[model samples]
Target: MSTLSYETELDKLLKGSNISHDLPVSQLVERALERKEGILTSTGALRATTGKYTGRSPQDKYIVEETSIKEKINWGSVNQPISKEVFENLYKKVLAYLETKDEVFVSKNFAGADIGYRLPIRVVNEYAWHNLFARQLFIRPNAEELLTHEAEFTVISAPGFKADPNLDGTKSETFIIVSFEKRTVLIGGTEYAGEIKKSIFSIMNYILPERNVLSMHCSANVGDEGDVALFFGLSGTGKTTLSADPSRHLIGDDEHGWSHTGVFNIEGGCYAKCINLTEEKEPEIFNAIRFGSVLENVMLDENRTPDYNDTTLTENTRAAYPIELIPNCVIPSVAGHPNTIIFLTADAFGVLPPISKLTKEQAMYHFLSGYTSKLAGTERGVTSPEATFSTCFGAPFLPLPAYRYAEMLGEKINQHDVQVFLVNTGWSGGQYGVGKRMNLTYTRAMVQAALLGELHSVETVVDSIFGLHIPTRCPGVPDEVLQPKETWEDKEAYDNKAKELASKFQENFMKFDKVSDIIRNAGPKF
Candidate 1:
């Protein structure tokens, strides 16, 4: 195994005062490891695991391939045999960090078919949690489900890194790995075995995509011809709710990977907002989790399992189950090139054009803008209605430097000739600040029109604000509903709200003012 240096940049940050609290790493790693072993020895683990978890290095271990992309990204092939050398390298990096944190405990269990180790609750600074752990270890609940039946699913490996403080006041960095089969998650060389799985999963979602996938914030899925469309925005921006249509076979909801052929889901399951979710509201997804669903971090009953009806855990309560659990799940983890790319934004300010066909630059512009209303309680810190701009509707986990993926999108759009559309999945007659949300039924109908290619037939008029062609009216939906009205319950209040939202959009567009004429003309769109 390569000798890993104990000092990582993250370690330095952990020791800084900016951190509110510190959990002992050395102590936690020990406990977490023990828990893992206990779980592995249990009947559940035995039934689930098929092959040996450890083995000698595979013959193809030493060969390294090259990519033109600037970063030295690792591309683990689906066909290549996993190597022990790689595992050792992971172990070494994890061990070095654990030792530095002084919170890790080592174990060698020879009694089982394979040897194992563990870690307990350990403190990891937020920076390390967000950048390193989130980036290196975060696994999508859905992706995990997709790999569940596969041999790679057994270990549930989690690699986390932390830093110690330096002279410049930054932390030294180190990495740690905790395997779930062993029931542990390590931080700063320490192990934590408590209710850390959910926390670990949450942090992981925050980072892992930056590695190799072409991740977008938009809702992406494979269409009939294998084309993928990505819908993006904050929670309640219609990512799960809108994409739940039965007409198109559902790929995974939310996050997706842009593979060479096309896009594939990174998750085996969907993490949807359950606030207003119901059989009538989201019938397709609501029925998907009846038997196989695993509700995470939820309020449990006497048996220590989740209470599906319990709202005590907060509205963010989530459920994870394999996509196959859904009545119709398209698998093989691949989707064809996107035929149409629809970026969904819930425009609270009803003044902006309802729908617009985007040119290439406009697509990137809106993606970077990442327009979505900050619904009151979806996130922890966001309390009010704030406009968020995430590149490609997914700013958080983008792996390649932003533009690289944009370039890839450009390449794909050019090659496959995919069409892009921006739809407001929010209110129309009023602004988010003052008006009511757009009716779900109407939004769904609009989406149906766009997907079926019927919206293109509407009379085209150059929108005054953005200059993009706005369909005068969708066939099934009313025209008056397309634009915000001034004569609602409070006309003056509606006008004020509209102005505020329009200004916000313009302000958000200022940074990208330098984009080329075609692209620029394509945006600053209302």
Candidate 2:
């Protein structure tokens, strides 16, 4: 299909009476129920199951091989390539399948919150709930902004349209193909709404960097005195939990860009994990789930109330809501250059320090390392903690080479003179099975101490293995807990465990051969 052919078909679909453009939340919820797409929970959140595919189908994701971006992308297993023809065929198929639907949902909005850097985006969905998901997850344009909005990137998602792996060059029935030349994303065969959200993130990760903005997968917040902080970590590392402090105004929960002027949110809403969510533990996120919010794969009780602790469907259960729902959220989701950067890690090995200040070299090393751990029983795997390192804390969404983003971060840190800290929220005395998880109260205290400058210029002791500058004591935390080695019951056992974990760090950092010697020496000494 030529550009004109697809444009004509898409224009016909958009101009039809069956197309619903920017329908209010109430009507979309009504349409979803009428179509039996999902059920409304007692809290009025629309609960939708994603069938067998409850999470992202990374194996089926691809980037079209266009000449312009061929040399730019980090082409490997992480970024699989498909010919341009395959993308065009799939794009046509998705659009054609959407035309056959009784109604299609369209949403036009922006990605970045900063007016100068924002990317105008449009989302076309085959399901009403999906449109609502897009509405709740992406930026919602005001009436004035909508008047002149022209989408720079358009996403077309048709979950009912499955690809033929053999015929369509897809790995499976699912496909998430992005064509950089077309500025279009085509997603199919996955009812999981996160695909719709992350697809645009992938686009921003590519586009923003070219515009001299550093795109990041992190949560940000602003303090009372106007200090901005960034929390970087992979899933289950308490990035969301720590960033949503009632004392601080949230800038955004995920996806942001650091432009020449300052930092700005790339999303208008938050997609929070709802598994085991409780009001006492996370009142902000819990209360945010309301009439317009979309709840994915969450089980309901007999009274139609959400079972936050239930994981029968999936532990990846989530809540999607606009940023306005959070009482302490910054309206524009913009902040100044970060005064502090915290790299969070759930180190199940229990070897990393609880709170350790980082040098610029160490910060760059750990930022690129992006280390975290996967606890046992989290997936279908064996019962043990597995070390997981995602470069820059977000490997899957980054479209460019890892070095591109790392170099950008190094420059930003140097220019801003940002203070960086590595905080371990996973384990303390021993490894996962033996040692318990870090105390939430103590973790909060340590984070607060760092944010408030309580630990700056404080007494410190360097770790023998990891070489992290650990604070001697924190305000509300126990003195012994400050040193992980002191809390261990067996002295010799702790040494062996620490050495094993240190060696893992050394091995993982080996992939970055091009990294400067100063940054390389910042890793574990073992």
Candidate 3:
């Protein structure tokens, strides 16, 4: 039997339209520049602006409620359900729109680094830069793999195609709908490149857990001795920054799956926050922006050098670069079971301790709570640090119940005897306005101590409200700063803030009624 060709599969979607299949990175970059899709910055990075939609439009995203996976889905405000009829109509429309186009670019890649569980994906993009974006973001297939490649899932992205809300049964012109039964993702109306990356993540989140693998939205790195550490956090909590440690080998910056054998990265690249990026602070990420990297929504000066401090377009400015660009990244992006799991939180309220040890039950509680502040401009219309609770650190991408993931994490922690720590990279001394952000050096030192097991014998003091075992004697951090209450001039005010935050935690936990009582009881008590 003859092997299926990439062009043949792409032709089925093209409907006789011109197709550009698996173009080399150089050609893709040349085509993107010729099309005026983006400009080459002085640093040799391609800076592209996602018109109208600088960030993800979660409200416009949907999943087809087909019979096969309908009941399995945790249908809610996040996983909004659309009818099969609606999906069919939109899918047909998207195909027709593509057929009318003069040309389209296609790239074939895999989503997981572990070959056994990897998902073969073919991304069809109407824009050249988007093809480059997909190439950099997803794991590229080698010549041998490409020859036999059959896309298990396909993403048809046409940012120029807008939807009619009334006619299409959509919320707005922008739509990102996933059809598990069809094994296809249809993205239209928004040009945000992250939509492509996250669509695959959502699919993995749904499929991996059923296979007994725990898929996570976190960052992972391994020490010199091969001890692995996982960092779980939402935007602005330093998951990317802290995980890119020079001394350690970076397994991946985001999206990983932990199976029985070990942990593997889901992405081939890093989508790092570029706002206020500097070579002095993050040399690896800053330097990784040269050639082949795609800078999204970042401002460039007359000299075409990126203005990292500029947020005029959006604070959610990002750079997408392949893992190899980072000097110390681990190839194949897989590592052994993690010895330490860190839950990073940017507590705008500033009453939480800088770092604390977590009991298994507490780990489950915080995992479900997924508390963090939503930094400005990460999403459309978001302008300030708003208290947000995303179950499992990435609720938007999750299709199953929050408890399902928390249950998997609990089992993994026990099975591996993994030490869990909750590190607050947010505010201290006072709330957001009055308090300063936690010092990065102190946070790094605390994390280092945890990774090296230096905190095992350290003295701890319990926070009465939150019940976290705050370490009193971290090596490099000041004694006073370890305790949130002591760092504040007004202790009474700190007490009030702690209770308020504790009450918020309880309120959030109320939504997860199906969680175990042990986990519920482990939460903060006012």
Candidate 4:
């Protein structure tokens, strides 16, 4: 029989609750079905709904201000500050609430694939399904490693426990508080499984940079010749889908750290957006959705088969599966330095070219701008395609200042002589409503050309307003499509929209201080 030694320590924290430690997948699945927390789809995958919060509650997230790392944090609207007293008080309440629960599921895992930098973490979930999520998302340890493991950071999640805004100093009843001093994260009032994954990512974002490691919110893949390429973009920009290329070995679908040695994946799994998923488009991700995968807020048909097209539940429908499930995954999830970096944007305005090479300064400018269009229904309250700027392509999960990550990225690009490209995965002819979405085949061909360095020898034209070098020709792409303005019937309309987006870029750049003149001048000049 396996020992329950780990539970003894957790039992003291979650007093009075029936502690279920390191339960196997079968047992956890049984417990989840027994409690009706989730159901098994015909494919044997577990389907669960995260009531009230189908997505991350970014507004409710907090970082406790303490003496140890008060100034280190970029405290503002994004990284909200909570007094140490508030964290302590709420911490006690969360534990007390967990104690009252009938059962608690515990998962002990590691966060980084690189053992040297990996953080040992323990996650305590109120629902068995959540434990299953931790199992699929985090790096699992063997029996011997589990016996001797000690968590560097711990996450206590009880979605059933809602905070009192007036008393707990939170924006709402939902809260996700990270205490650096206590080395713990307390999550309540939100059952979004993403919270569990992102909490660890936030911690790593803070911890990794301090160690001179550049933590990135991007997807990575390695070519046959060991060439590494990074895809940086926000949620809807196809980072996950594009990086799962059959021609390359996927390092990871999301979250990576670039150190002096190489790039390492911060996660052991891929949490892919499942809405509109089709087997013909993404055969690998589609095929990986069988047993052991956890589907969140996904709608199902009468036969209990998942309806990837259905958004009745949520547009943020996701599927979490281990990286090994991907046919072309790197086992250790580590690779040498990246040779090329692609910044992806879903440009709803369609004024941006389908693909453009970026100068060093321009790369830094776009990295800080991190512009992407959020399609309607991707998140609650988003009714249309809205242009959004998230620094480093993932501002919400970043705990440090935006410039720190940008600086690290710039340094890496210079040191390694990396080629950078800006690829628009958004619109082409006019705007979101008027222009058609960029054909996936064309996008793939452009990406392939960029990766293969075929565009280096191609003739280029400078975008007058945006100051971007647009390639006049690519191997498989039409010459007319290379120039976005030429593709539009009304050239004047394209000019107007391009200038408008340029103004928005300038306006957003004003928020950052102490940026170099080179980066400052790299924006659209209209």
Candidate 5:
């Protein structure tokens, strides 16, 4: 209602609480407004409180920092005509933001001839950083020229994006900057500044002169006997919690890339689920948030902290906190190739409880399945057991071709000889509303077995309905819970529920039937 600068609005946003308790808004604002004069001649050149390297190799000296408009502020309320010229005319502002800084790293990318900015840590917010590494903003770049350009990092902005293809065809409101050396990124959209945190860990790890690593989408950490189990799943699966095991040493969670040498984390922070989360249920994750955590758009309490009990705002709650909060967070987020790669599913029918040992065909089947329930308030309102397809794990946010990455994965599994398993983190024995969620503790134990290489040896029965191989005994889980059962308060109700879920899976998979016969058979066998 009153005239206010973008700084003023940023002040309010900074002071506001995210789902995570503390977000250094003032610190972020101050840095965002800093000067950008000096040139960075060093190998790597970005410096936040923790500082980072932006070079591909030891000798490379990329642009340290750049500038842009602070678009998150609501200019209409302030009577400022919405500025769409930001993408083209924000160099002065970028310099002003860089004026206060000593050394920083920035990257730029060109797709064909389309140029994009990879803003320094200052201009990009924590939330934006999250989506960047999630590969949500992967653009089709001019690979030939990109290789020629000295500045391999650049940021971009695409406004008014609605994740729909038909109605809002070619319409999206997303801005992101990607890094080549660190292979990290920062992403944001109009409604939200940054929805997910990616590239923070691997970027930080890249700077450190320790383990040579690269960021990935698979979750891996040190487990029993120093064996690390890598958990790979589509969204809504329990990759974060299952990998955040207190009993094991956590390397990193979510988004890992592997090579002949080692594995690395692509995120600077952790983007964790906050819907109905409690300290008692996930102490490792609960404790990870404190000083460096940035809570994203969650309803706060009088104390300006997350009210986990309160669900009035939005259930798509998320927290962005530094990985250092995890007990044994390793810098340069790298580890030996995963001993096990587990595919996770949140089967709403409650019929799939923690299955394991997916054959290569089954792996490709579920890989293309990309199943997960949509958030209640987000896009299409809460619907019944929705089956979405993402090429590898994420289809919306990737820079490289989906099949290229998938081929890489298939090769890695063969080369490194990594074992793969499938686990459902959602409801079991009953549907979502009707059945209780399987204990996170049980899921953790089953994952531990997979990582420890115990589940790989003893698997036998083929599940009648899903056609998945069921392991007889998964160290921590009882034998009976291996297969999903149609158990409901009413027998007819169970039949109807299973039928409904089956139908949904069938329809979603029908389109991909040409991809493979296994995936063609992904629908409920009955």
Candidate 6:
């Protein structure tokens, strides 16, 4: 069948009473409980388990090779390409499977917070809980907007539909296929709801850049003076924790777009990590988990209260809640262009400065580098912390060339005179097992100094290896703590470890073929 044939048929399947259209959170949660799709925790948040798959199946993800995006996509292991026939076959299977269900859920929403740039989206899920995940994660349209809504892109997720790899042309029974030409994302076999959220982000990563908007994988907030700040980091890097400042109004916890006018959140809600969660550590997130929020894979004790520390299911436990649930969240989730940018890294090696100012070139360099560390015991055969570098801070979601996003960021930084910094939230004094982690109080103090412009004119000393400008003094932090080597018991060991990490940076940068000499020179020096 032709693409139009399937598109025309989808409209008919979605309009009947068998489709629960635009259900509220209460109705969705009720349906989910009645259907036994999930259970309600003591806090009133619904908890659902993603049966075989607890995380994203990146290897099985694909983008259809169509004439429109044929020459544009960075096509590789990250953005794999499949044929139109394969996508059509799998998409048909999913829709037909949904037809067999007692009922399906649908939601009409927007993606970008900026009205001008917002992309109208429709999500159709075989599970009620998944639809709730969509409604909470995406920008929910008002009643007036929904009456006139027409989705430019559609996501059809039927986790019950399992593909036949041989006949279905899939890497596995689980597959996430995005057909830009068809304006649809077809997910099957995997029960993971995060796939639904990320698939849309991957699509936005493609669509927004074409409009000259730089889509970013970062958390944002605005100070009292309306000075905006951006925090870029991967999971476990404290991006969410740092951006949840009691003093600053949070713009969004993850995924934002920078257009000519200013910064806007791409998501209507925040999906926070729930492992090791505590009210004392993240009070806002703890309080936000009431009534309408959705929790994934979090264990519950006999009293039906969530055990945030339990990881029997997976370490990637998450909770999705509306942005407004956060008391200090910006109403429209919009802000002026960022005045400050912080690249957060948990450098376990304990060599980088606690906090340091960055030059434009260095910012671009580090932005592209996107460095972090994976601690030992987190994975098998890992006896020590390992270096991790994801380009543009979000390599998995970037469908376009890495340099495309990097160039856009550089242009924006130059145009707005943005100040960027690298803050290490990892171990200090020595590598992971040897030293204590950087104090959260001190980390917050250093970040506050940067946001308040306290580090702007303070006396600075340049690091010999990485060329980062370290602030000599910071409020609420001892002077020695600001210097990594000064706190270390053995100074020579610090130099050796610093050099070791510098080599890893050089090795990772060799993959980029388009970086310029100036930005290239901004990395660590031997």
Q: How many steric clashes between backbone atoms does each model show?
A: 68, 0, 0, 0, 56, 0
lDDT of 3 by residue, 1-526 (tens): 1124433444577556478899988888898999899989998889999877988899998999988998999998889999988877887788778878777899899999998889999999999999999999999899999999999999999999999999999999999999897788999999999999999999999989999999999999999999999999987798889999898999998899999988999999999999989998889999999889999999988999999999888999999999999888888999999989999999999998999999989999999999988888777888888999988999989999887888889999999999999999999999999998999889999999999999988889988999999999999999999999988999899999889889999999898878879889999987
lDDT of 2 by residue, 1-526 (tens): 6778877877888898889999999999999999999999999889888887777777778999999999999987768999998998888778778888889999998899999889999999999999998988788899999999998888999999999988988888898889888888899998888888888988999999999999999999999898999998876687778888898999988789999888999998888888889998889999999999999989999999999999898777889999899888998889899989999999998878899999999999999899988544323332466788889988888999889899999999999999999999999998888998898789999999999999998999999988899999899999999899987899898899899988887899999999989999998896
Using lDDT, rank the candidates from best to worst.
Answer: 3, 6, 4, 2, 5, 1
Best lDDT among the predictions, by candidate number? 3
Q: List runs of model 3 lying over 4 Å from the truth.
A: 1-11, 15-17
Query: 287-375 in candidate 1: lDDT tens per residue?
Result: 66443333333444465433446655444555444456555556544566677888777765665555667777777666666777666
How much does each candidate deviate from the true structure in C-alpha RMSD?
A: 12.7, 1.8, 2.8, 3.4, 13.0, 2.1
Off by over 4 Å in 1: 1-213, 222-228, 297-312, 376-378, 486-499
Cα-based TM-score, every candidate: 0.61, 0.96, 0.97, 0.96, 0.64, 0.96
lDDT of 6 by residue, 194-249 (tens): 78888899999998999999999999999889999999986667777888889899
Where model 5 places Cα greater than 4 Å from the true spot, the runs are: 1-26, 29-151, 156-216, 224-226, 377-385, 399-401, 475-480, 489-526
* 123-151: candidate 4 lDDT, tens digit per residue: 99999999999998998888998999999
Clashing pairs in 4: none
The TM-score obtained by model 2 is 0.96
Q: Candidate 5, residues 1-526: lDDT per residue as tens digits?
A: 1224433543443244331211233333233334321111111111111111110110111111222323221122111222223322232233233333343322222211012112223222232232222222222123474455442333322212212313222123232333332232423233332322332322322322112222235677775565657776655577777878777776666666455555655544466666677889888777765543444345554545566566454554555565666787665455566666777777766766476677666666666566655434322233344555554555433433334455556667767777777788877767777777777877877877776667767857876566777788777777767656533556566666666766666776665534656446544677
Question: What overall lDDT goes with each candidate model?
Answer: 0.47, 0.88, 0.91, 0.89, 0.48, 0.90
Query: Model 6 compared with the native: what TM-score?
Result: 0.96
Worst 10 residues of 1 by lDDT: 109-118
The CA lDDT at 264 in model 5 is 55
